[model samples]
Target: MLRRSPHHRWTLVSRVMVGVLSLLALGGIVVAFAAFAYGRSAARQAFDPLLVGAAQDIAESISIGDEGPVIDLPVSAFGLLSLAPEDRIFYAIHGPDGALLTGYDGIPAALDTVQPRFRDWTLQDDAARFVTVSRLFSERAYAGRIYVTVGQTTRARRAMALDLTRRALFVTTFGGIALIVSALIIIRSAMRPLEVLTRDLAQRDPYDLTPMQADGPQEVRVLVGALNRFMGRLDRQVGAMKNLISDTAHQLRTPVAAIRAQAELALEDDAPRRLPRLERLVWRTRSLGRLLDQMLSRALVIHRIDNAAPTAIDLRDIALTVLDSRDHELLAPGKDVQLRIGEDAVVVLADEISLTEAVRNMLVNALRHGATPVVIGVSPTPTGSAIWVQDSGDGPPDAVRATLGQRFERSAASKGNSAGLGLSIVRAVAQAFGGEMTMATVQGGFRVSLTLPHHGAGQSQ
Candidate 1:
């Protein structure tokens, strides 16, 4: 059964827009609330002073006459209260003894003090605001105090507050929407570089491993750098694999053709002559197998050189291990492979498997081309460590020796049976470890040495 992968919910731009819009919306709501409160307070401040002026005018109309306190409500007082025409106006006058002298008896005086007071109350079924003013009448007939009260329904004040709040709401709504839209546009513009980068990567060829340009914001540049490094590693690995396939096909062609020819000859011969032909066929098959083995060995050495991390390896131990392996006996039968080690430890930085394969190839090559009694030795050089294979025969000519480590280039002494990949593998291993391979004629015999840099001598440590 197949299962589907989960899809991504949001992209970077969407996330940024959502976050910014959310904050703006929250801020807009807070601003709206503050506007409502400020509008209500400003409405009260503006209208309350008008209500006080009306009450004072009504107080000034009271007089201490012979009968008692005479009150005549002024038309100017009513005119002032009528400024807010939508509101209902009411007024009342009271004697010092709390009796209603004139005007409406329904209206209540809030305080008995001599100072004016303003308050809010319910009149009939409507909300109302009122102001009360008290005055002293000190005449012969009347020597006491009088109270006057004025009130108006709150329709005008509520209308003004509503208008202010509507204006604020309109402005904030449009401004917040404009800001959110502007933010989205800016976000899209900022992400243009990433979009271009994505398009470039998607359109690239599968084998392309070129590094991308690190041009963008700092965070994006970091991502591009990592991608470039990864592509570099992939390029090297792919190149190694391609070389492996090409070399295998090229080197196996000759041996495979020889095997096929010998097989045909064996099949055409009679029983008495077939045996010799079959023997040759078997030998050719074994040679083909050896060629394949060397080709694979060389490919593995190159792969390890490119990919494997190096560790401190003692060259003396590698030499001894190569000498003790069964390959030595199989390649040089009835001959003991000698190993010589110096007094000091000879350590170099290298991959152990690659180094061992290189040494083994050198041993096999010496036994195949030179005489018996091959000596594998390790010693500390002035710069690093040296391991060499010395045998009892003169080496190839100087011309062949100069090109010894090249792939599939064998000496005149090496017949067609030789794969010619042995020294090439050795040289690759030496170069991987910051070393070099040298060929020399010494003691009337051939010597091939791999000189490696010391582990603790440089940055390789």
Candidate 2:
């Protein structure tokens, strides 16, 4: 069974909107609670003064009479308490001995000597607010202090507080919703640039690698730049592939045609002369095979140069491996491929496969064009490491040597047998490693060197 990939993706807008709305909802709840508390406190402030006023009026109305003290509660005291029409009012007056002189006896008097105080209590089994006040009176008949207590049911005050709290909650809730909606709209507007960028990319041709216009917010610009860089790399890869295909087709055409023509000639020849023609055909076929192999090798080297990661490579080890290979023994029988090196390990940073291919090609070139006693040497230079192939024969002329590394360009000496890609492959490998290929005539022979950057001792093994 084919397993499906997980589908868990979230959009930036949705995440932002969810986060913003959550914060707004939390803020709205906090604001609603604050409004309720402020409203309740304001309701208490508005009603406390009325209760105090009524208590003071009652205290002032008390007078001295023939019985020692008398109480004549004023109508204004009840009028003041009637401000909250839906509430029941209660009052009490106490003499010096703590005995209720007049009014409701159930209402409690002040305990301490406090002049005025407010409290919440249960009266007639209903929640009520009350204020207590003490007043001093001096008269010829009687001189003492009287206490007044006034209270009322909290129904009307609670109603007012609830109305205020409800209004505040409604306003806060509406404003919070508006803020959320506005935030969403702003988020969408801000994302338009990204949308346009996506649409532009979707509408373009598949092969197009043109850079996009990086105009937007800094974040969007960075994204566009990254996309453009990726496209640029893809374009280079595609171009390399195209060039390789084109070169392969063009170079192989002549040799393949030549092989077919030679085969036809061998077929037409009579029995006695057919052997020589068949031999020529075989040689032509082998040359064509060699050409194809070299072309493919060059292509592989180019591909690796573009894609492969570099590692620590010892040039002496690579030279020994290449010399010991079957192909090397076939090319130069009798152990003619010699190795010469310094004492210390000659190490460089390179891709081993490509570097080996390059060295193999150089050795093949020296064997094909120069005399026997071919030598492969590795040594450490001041800046890097060098791997060279030398042979005992006159090298190409100065003019031809200058153009030796160019693709499909061969010296007059090796034109018929060479595909002219060997030196080019070596050059490419050297350049890939930030190195260079050098040719010089030494004694009576020629030497070609591939020098690469040395890996320092501090680098990881």
lDDT of all the models against the reference? 0.84, 0.85
Mind giving the per-residue lDDT tens digits that candidate 2 earns over 1-461? 97654433567788888799889888878887888788888988898888999989888887788877778888998897787888999888788778887778778667455579888888889999888898776888777788899999999888988888899889888888888889989999999998888899999999999898999999999999999988876776787688678987897788788878878888898899889888888888888888888888987887787688898888888898788785767865664667887667778899999999999999999988988788999876676789999998889899999999988888888858888899999999998789999999998579999998878772222
TM-score against truth, every candidate: 0.58, 0.68
Q: Write the per-residue lDDT of candidate 1 for residues 61-94, one digit (tens) a residue.
A: 7776677777777888888668798889988888
RMSD of 1: 7.5
Error of 1 at 105 (Å): 22
Best by TM-score: 2
Q: Stretches of candidate 2 above 4 Å error? A: 1-19, 34-196, 210-218, 305-321, 324-326, 340-350, 370-395, 430-461
Which candidate comes out best when scored by lDDT?
2
Which ten residues in a row are the worst by lDDT in model 2? 2-11
